[model samples]
Target chain A: MTALIAFDWGTSSLRAARLDERGQVLEERSSTDGILQVPAGGFPAVFERITQGWPLHGATCLASGMVGSRQGWREAPYCPCPAGAAELADHVLWLDDVPGGARVGLVPGLSAREAGVPDVMRGEEVQVFGALQRLDTDHGLFVLPGTHSKWVRVAGGRITGFSTFMTGEVYAALRQHTILARTMAEGAQDNTAFLRGVQHALRAGSLLHGAFSARALSLFGELTEAAGGSYLSGLVIGEELRAQRLQNSALQPVLIGSPALTRRYALALSVLGVQARELGAEATWQGLWSLAQTLDTTA
Target chain B: MTALIAFDWGTSSLRAARLDERGQVLEERSSTDGILQVPAGGFPAVFERITQGWPLHGATCLASGMVGSRQGWREAPYCPCPAGAAELADHVLWLDDVPGGARVGLVPGLSAREAGVPDVMRGEEVQVFGALQRLDTDHGLFVLPGTHSKWVRVAGGRITGFSTFMTGEVYAALRQHTILARTMAEGAQDNTAFLRGVQHALRAGSLLHGAFSARALSLFGELTEAAGGSYLSGLVIGEELRAQRLQNSALQPVLIGSPALTRRYALALSVLGVQARELGAEATWQGLWSLAQTLDTTA
Candidate 1:
């Protein structure tokens, strides 16, 4: 029987997993009914539908991501960081009135202000903790690259601070909505083109100027239409990495994302003479499981 | 009688000026018939309609901007820089076969290769030359702020090179299409917010990360909804200025554009302790008239 029903719910998709007492995944399911898709007062029904027939008796439900955002089922206020599994367990907003009395908790997202600018993250925090658990370490730097990439710093087992980069989202917007779209043609992954873009970005110093190169290079017949998209991807990801220089930190950075995203980040990071470790979605599950374990002891 | 019918044509609108023998604007008219709006092979008709009663019997008609693009009435291959009035007059793509037997020349745009990247501009070349003629000096840095802002360099009576930054388009895209839109409200000009954003961007060092601050700052109530758009504008324009550092070049950059846009640019440039001279649509008219004068000399 499942001991915890854990979810990594975000803007576009909802993923649920049934974990045994030992935090081993017994079964898993996902759907397009992410928090954004849930109508007002519709989360309970979608929750029940997704978790139907699963043994809910004595099971604790916990969800992370935009599911806790202002638009989610219920607002779980962001927990100010320097936070870890213990801090997260304490702030978990419980939805006890869930139809079947299923003990459900919405994991509060983490928020931090650095250099007078506030930064926040939801689902990626879980992935960060999960990577820590998987690696059996308390201190590390973790980068979760996606629509909003998070570069987190974990010190003495807590997320001290982090920064968010709108790299992927900007890339998509420019490729689809701007004039650069005319010159770019989506094709297979071109590592050579991608790395070249990364190199150009590192030296270019301004994204406003560097991004125009994608169009300019194409106009000059230097960048082929087939490789334009890849080159653009490299420029964006490269800009992100250029901002995150590892300033003599002894701990190597761990990149947490899907294989495709992580691979690109890893390649970009490699250009700086820094080797990074990559992890996948399993980190989210592990992070949630670790938080769930803490909740068990506290309750 | 009008000596010339000069056009400053672009992507979204067209402006026509009837210039007397001395290149003074005798009458001026405009239309929404930009190159993109014209139907297939509709340039000649649009031209005739816009200049319907204007004397074209002995007037040499000339056009500048996207009207010379491949998708325009005719593709005028971009003239390589160090280009000036003489070079532009030499490369004008003449289309003498128009139905009305009106002699016409499509002003070629300028193209430059810098740091192994190619940069091109269509109508702005005419504006640069016009500003030069108006200022009566050849060596100066010219910045034309618009959808695609061009920063051009002139030396020894010719435009040596230039760079284009998609600052305005990127701002629009982020405001309309991205999550940042939720935090941003299009309010009246907020100079405090604008300068604050410029200060933030100058310090932020990475646009991908700096852009996210628009959302993050709003999330924390540090940036108000009313001030978001202005702050974003400052950030984008700041990033552009950051890339084009003056580098001890003893020339006050000339800004040519609509008053609203040039005003923002002048304000942004002021932060760096530089005063920029401003120009209006008159520059384009003067540029076309200057080129037309050259045609008279060489004819």
Candidate 2:
């Protein structure tokens, strides 16, 4: 039987896991019916479609991410840092009688304010929290790579702070909309060129100037169009690594994401002589499970 | 009446001017028929349409910029620096007995390769040469801001070297294609926010990190959507200026463009404690005039 139905809904996709009382996932399901893909307040139906055959119809639903943003199913205001499971649980936005009679608790993401730079993360906070729990470390930096890559800090089981880098979005935008679009060929990625890009970023000091190298290298025949995408990816990621000061930091970084993305990030970190450990998507599940546990205790 | 037909043909628009023997603009005409908009090798036809009814239809034609690019009317190969009017004239691709009985000379852009970061400029070199000539500076830096902002070093009436920064393109793509799109508003720019963005970039160390601040501050209620675009612009221009090391540079910058762009760029420089002089679109015309002079001597 499903003890909990935990969902990690974002802008582009939806993922849900049915877990037992001990937070062990019994069954998992996912769909591309992201909140944005569905009409406003139509999330319950999309959730139903994804969970059609699941027996845990009435289980408590603990959700995180953009689903709780102002534009999502409900607005779960950000829980300011240093935020832990306890702080997030206190702000969990509860929805009564959501489809299938499941009571929904949308977990609030964490926010950080610094000198003139304010940042917030929606779904990645769950991964960061789960990363902290899985690694069983009181303190360590965690990197969650996605459209908006996050470099996060956790101390005493709380999200101390984090910054968002527009690395992946930049790659996509340049490839699809800019002059680089004409030069980047899509197909099998070239690892050798990617590494060269990483090396170039490490050596080049500024991204404002470094990004043009994508076009320059390709135009000059240094990098074939087929491999330029990978090179650009490496360059942007390398810039991210440098900007975040992740390279050669005292504390090793724990990268949380799918195998492919984390692997690329791990490769980049290794290139910079910084070792990083990769965690699977299960980390996100565990994070939702932790939030479920917090809600259970509070209730 | 019509002694010369000089065209500043760029990616999105084309401007052709008729000048007397003294290089005075007797009449000027423009069209949206840029090189990119024309069909393959259809530049002659577009030129025909723009020059209709002009008595200078049979006059000597000098076209600079993308019109000579690989995808342009014909590939006018780039002349490596330190190239001046004489070297450029020698390398200019000549087309004999074209439509309207006009011989065409396409001005070649300058290319620089340094430390694996290759740079190229197409239409801006004209402005750079003209700015150098107009400002009467033997040795100084010139900044031409656009999709690809060029920082040039000219000495003794020759183009020594230059670097291209993908500043404006990144800003456009990030606003149009990325998550930041949701947070940016168009119309009625906010200069205060733009200056603030410039300040943030000056203080922040990384463009990858700093670009996110436009969205972040808006999300945190520090910036309105309408003002966010200006801030983003300032961030990009600030990043561009910083990457080119204008803050502490001894040589004053020469800003080239239409009035609006140059004004903003000049403001950005003054904010950084650097003074910059503005040049009008006539600089480009003067540039073409100089190239026209070079071709005349050789012809």
For every candidate, give the share of true A-B contacts it also has.
0.88, 0.83
Q: Best-fitting candidate, measured by lDDT?
A: 1
Model 1, span A140-165: residue lDDT tens: 88998989989999999899999888
Which residue pairs collide in model 2, if any? none
Which candidate tops TM-score?
1
Candidate 2 error regions (>4 Å): A1-3, A45-60, A99-102, A294-299, B1-4, B45-60, B99-101, B294-299
lDDT: worst 10-residue window of model 2 chain B: B242-251
Q: How well does chain A score by TM in each candidate?
A: 0.97, 0.94
Q: How well is candidate 1 docked (DockQ)?
A: 0.74
Which residue segments of model 1 deviate by more than 4 Å? A246-251, A296-299, B246-251, B296-299
Interface RMSD of every predicted model, in angstroms:
1.1, 1.4
